[model samples]
Target: MKKKFSLLMLMAFAAAYPQDVKAPDMSSPKWLRNAAISPDGSQIAFSYQGDIFTVPANGGSALRLTIHEAYDSDPVWSRDSKMLAFSSTRYGNKDVFVISAGGGVAKRLTYHSAADVPTDFSPSGDKVIFSSSRLDDAASSVFPTPILSELYEVKLAGGMEKRIFSASAEMAVYNADGSMIFFHDRKGYEDPWRKHHTSSVTRDLWLFNTKDKNYYPVTESIYEERNPVFAGGNN
Candidate 1:
């Protein structure tokens, strides 16, 4: 009983006067890209040096996740924050790749030749939505002469890909209920290098329904409205 009491007192004293420990060395010359917050709001996932990494949200040494020769960018977190979906060119093509949030070997999700850039995960966390420029052969559609893009979703376990929106959609995020998706759209969108030019190529915000497959305009104006996000946890 006396030893137990002493241990308890030591624990109490430590809690009362905790020591500040230094974080891990995070110094790196490589550029950091595509940083994402975990679902629980504890950690952040990012891509650096052609690989994926996770670091403490506050400050600490980052944990490296993926190590590959191919370039990996645009890390998107699952709703549960246990997994991350990113785009990699390791398989000779830019396709979606999923990896554990902690760190591990990444699994390829998409195998198409077209570049599939992961944009967001479904609210249910079962499907991952991405943007692709490769045209779907089944859909007899017509896009701009050179550049064309659309939104698509694939299962986490890997299966048939589904087309969500048939437009030049970028960064499409789903609501909490997964009934609606909000994204920035600019079919044949102009390049950002054209800083001063204001043409019809300006991107607009649009909302699409997953159930009815109906889409409508949220905001349309001369000014470019891109990167639409939900606030208050998409409530």
Candidate 2:
């Protein structure tokens, strides 16, 4: 029942790129991922070395935010760009936390037993969408594999978390207009190299319409596409 570590889990999510794409320069210390621009589009917040960091949008020195030993990543700027919300394991479990954009004490947002990782913020800046398995009955099962990770929204100021949809998703991100959410679901599969060894898996993009309360697949191919964000805007 233990969670299976597939390629998707290690790379975070699968993104479709041209087959001729060159491998990234992993040797450079400045390489980063999950780059989110500020609302004003003047700066970017990203994760590096297990903590969140910020740098000028035009490229400059990076400033470290959290100094905790636990893993911290997936940083997103609030709509107003006054604060930052991200996921961290500082509290002994992966949970969402918010801190001032200018740097200050971080505030814990979710208290779930499992993991609550915020993916993106609504355009209005009133809510945040995240993925978690906190509702699953972990104690009742032997291996406690994350059977399903549903998307939920909680007020940026803090309040009751409401389930937006129940599905086996990995990372969830809200669209620019806040009318829809895109996520990646773990489509279970069997290990090809080892016979009789089933493993937790995922591949496919799912779009959830907030207005209609419906979920549907955007693509049927087996590719991991995740951490999607609205590109090109006034910021």
Candidate 3:
């Protein structure tokens, strides 16, 4: 009887004095997308909660670069690491826009009905290259379809956009000397929500020579390959 009474008194005392609870950390937000590390390897820019943010590559507090209500994503760092170009739906359809690394007014780079998604900045950082289905090249023999996208580049100063490649090139980037481009070809569209299945229209990586205007397949696998990149200065 004495032991039971002591135990009950201890339980009552513990229930009366609860431990302190810590608050949840909101710094590391979830569902971060389109993360791109700067060329200098100092900072990382990503899309989180419908806005763009930059944080130290080593990990630290995140700095919000954009606070717009419209959906903004696809952050691409310039070669110099001083600027960032991203896609935004501020004007209805997705269009390419550029902002400073430190954050400021975003300048619209492309204005077209077709969605312009910035893939990478030019080697000289003078222009921003993007993928769009606006039009097929005049010399292109492929049929006109929305599934296919063409590569186009608009000057940072903002002028007429010149079509660089007439095929469906995605995640395209230039080599060190700008002599070649590495990208993956999108043959056609597929239902992303459907179950994964192998098909003949799987994406393949390709290397394109700027001088000859010719492209060669880097991978001929039956499975899908994507986002090709050059490593260690080797073309």
* Number of the top TM-score candidate: 3
Error of 1 at 208 (Å): 0.5
**After aligning candidate 1 to the native by TM-score, how far in Å is the CA of 23 from where it should be?**
23
Candidate 3, superposed: residue stretches over 4 Å from native: 1-27, 192-196
The TM-score of predicted model 3 comes to: 0.86
Candidates' C-alpha lDDT: 0.83, 0.75, 0.89
In candidate 1, how many clashes are counted?
0
* Candidate 1 local lDDT, 142-188, one digit each (tens): 65432567889999989888887677788888888888889987656
Worst 10 residues of 3 by lDDT: 188-197
RMSD of each: 15.4, 13.0, 7.7
Q: Which prediction has the highest lDDT against the true structure?
A: 3
Q: State residue 183's C-alpha deviation in candidate 1, in Å.
A: 0.6
**Cα lDDT over the full model 1:** 0.83
The deviation in Å at residue 137 for candidate 1 is 8.9
Q: Using Cα atoms with residue i matched to residue i, what is each candidate's TM-score against the true structure?
A: 0.81, 0.72, 0.86
Candidate 3: give its CA RMSD in angstroms.
7.7
List runs of model 2 lying over 4 Å from the truth. Answer: 1-33, 136-144, 189-202, 232-235
Task: Estimate, for each residue in 1-235, the C-alpha lDDT of model 3 and write its tens digit.
Answer: 9999999999999899988898877765568999999999999999997899999999888889899999999999998899999999999999999999998999998989999999989888899999999888787888888678899999999989999989889899888878888999887677523445468778889988999999998988657788777783645
